[model samples]
Target: MKVYLSVDMEGVTGLVDAEDVQPRGRDYERGRVLMTEDANAAVRGAYDAGATAVLVNDAHGPMRNLLPDLLDPRATLIKGRPKPMGMIEGLTREYDAALCIGYHARAGVLGVLSHSFMGHEIEDIWLDDQVTGEIGLFHATAHAYGVPVALLTGDDTACAEMTAWDPSVATVPVKYAKDRFAAQLVPVPEAQAAIRTTTHQALANLPALTADRARTRRLAVRWQNASVTAHLTAIPGVLRQDDRTVTVEADMPHLYRLFNLFLRVATAVTTNPPYC
Candidate 1:
């Protein structure tokens, strides 16, 4: 079986606050290793579920979180920013399934390390008029490509949040968020075990969704910070809603690419400086 994994840093084990997730931050290196280890656990699980090949995308900021030498040698890594699919680079209809590793919920979801792309610029997202998060948007894109999101690993809120969008997608709760930036730790080994178990369950019940269309879909974002939203909604198809949320209509099945572009524009506001 072929599987595609999208890996992010925030929900990885042993991480907290921006210091551990930001590139110039003091603890970012240690957080990166933790992120890589969690990804390997998912890799091990995918193999157990008969995944013959897995491609992992470094989905975090700058997209260079994984240590190449320490990654699971059995899989290939797609690293760097400005890539075609962004977080889910290698995804295609040819793949049997997809997995999201170390993911978190959108901003204000109480998930550990939770924040939408470009932080506050993304207040919320909607697909087909239903409120959604990055996971929902990603899953929709994967579905458009004829792939099922078999497994997901993240904080309890992340797991709970996904349950609403995809009840059947296997989920492993590696941490319980006490609040936005804090979580109760689950031993590293324990979290790994939960991830493996849930992955097996996910494989057993893959959703029967068709994936033979010409990558057409819509993704709209609502930004809490109006200063940023004003600019994004100014794009041709983008419509500004109220003062906080900006709606962008995109039909590209390659949503990640569009997502990458939005990140830059949303952060262009002078008041909300980037890297602060």
Candidate 2:
């Protein structure tokens, strides 16, 4: 079996604030080490479950947080930005399963470091009118490629979000949210052990995995700034909804690509730092 791991920093064990995940913060270096260790746990679990190959993506801000030297040697890493698929960049139908490691909840939620794709630019997103965040988008995109999301790790609220989206998928919460920047964190070693064990168990039930048949999906986003929304209307088929919203229709994978382009457009028109 082949496995794909999409790892983000905010929900990694022990991280609860922007300072932990952002590059400029004093604790960011330590945060990267913790992020890498969480990913290594998933890699180890995949191998233990008879995986022939594993691919890990550093899906955090700037897409450069993971420390390559410390990652498990058994997996290949996909890092850096401009990836059309964003967090789920390396996913394909060829893989048996995908794991969303260290993912947080959507913007406006009470979870450790919770926010949408952009820190504050994107207010909310909808696929076929269903509200979703990074976790939902990642699951939809992976399912589009005929790969099931077998495991996820995050704070308690993030775990609940995934369960509400799809109850069968396994989740391991490393922290319990008290507020956006505060949580009762699990010790690093204990969190890593739970992640490893849950991943192994999730992959063991791979035969039950099935891909979503729906391909065409309507994508919409509500931005904080009207200028950013207006800029996105320049794209063909993108319709302006009032001043701060835009909607578009496209097939899976392609739709995901368009969403990434929308984010780039938003970035060009705004200078707000994420999670500020």
Candidate 3:
């Protein structure tokens, strides 16, 4: 069996503040180590569960946060950006299952370091009128290829979000958020152990955990800045919903392409704001 692991930074063990996740922050180095270790734990768990191959995608900011030297030797890593699928880049139908590691809750939620993709730029995302986060969006992408998201690890709110999206998915909550920047955390070793155990169990029940493809696909992105939304409306199929939101009508595959395009445009506009 083959497994794909998408790993992000904020929800890793012992990470509770912005300082830990940013590259120039004082704790950034330690955060990278923790991120790598958590990913290694997941790779180890996948191997233990009879997976013949595992691929790990660095899904955090900069997309190069995981320390290659410390990553488990058994798995191949997909790092850096401009990839077609962003977070779920390396995913394909050949994989038996997928795991989302170190993911936090959606933006505006009470979870450790919680935010959706592009923390400050995107206010929220909705799929078919259902409020969803990065996890849910990526899960939908994986489902399009018939890959089940068997295991997820994060803070309590992230776990709760996944459970609500699909009850059969196995979740390991390494922390309980006290607020956006504070949490009651599980120790590093304990969190790693829980991830390993839950991953194994999830793979064992992979057949039962398979996610169903959505019958309809309509995505709405609410931007933090109205101008960003206006800029995105330039895309052929994107429709302006309001000053700060745009809606797109597309199937799963096309939606993924449009989403990537939106991210690229949004990032560009965010960094180089136009004077009104």
- Residues 1-276, candidate 3: write the lDDT tens digits: 999999998889889888898888899999999999999888988988999999999998889999888999889999998888888888887889989999989987878877778876788899999998888887788887788889889999999999998888999989899988899989889999999988988998886334344555999999888988888888898999999999998767568778988988888878732111
The candidate that wins on lDDT is 2
In order of appearance, the predictions have TM-scores of 0.90, 0.97, 0.95
- What is the descending TM-score order? 2, 3, 1
Give candidate 2 regions above 4 Å deviation.
207-214
Better of 1 and 3 by lDDT: 3
Predicted candidate 2 versus true structure: per-residue lDDT over 1-276, tens digit per residue: 999999999999999988889998989999999999999999999999999999999899899988889999989999999898888887888899999999999988878888898998888999899999999988888888788889999999999999999898999999999999999989989999999999999999975445654667898899999998778888999999889999998776888888888888888889989988
Winner of 2 and 3 under TM-score: 2
Candidate lDDT scores, in order, read: 0.79, 0.91, 0.87
RMSD for all candidates, in order, please.
2.4, 1.2, 2.8
- Model 2 residue 135 CA deviation (Å) reads 0.6
The window of 10 residues in a row where model 2 has the poorest summed lDDT is 206-215
Which has the greatest TM-score?
Answer: 2
Q: Write the per-residue lDDT of candidate 1 for residues 1-276, one digit (tens) a residue.
A: 888999988778777678889888899988888888888888888888888898999998899989999999998999997776777788888888899998889776767767776665466777767877778878888887889898888888888877887887888888889877788989988888777777766776777778745655566677666676667666677676678765555555745576666777764564452222
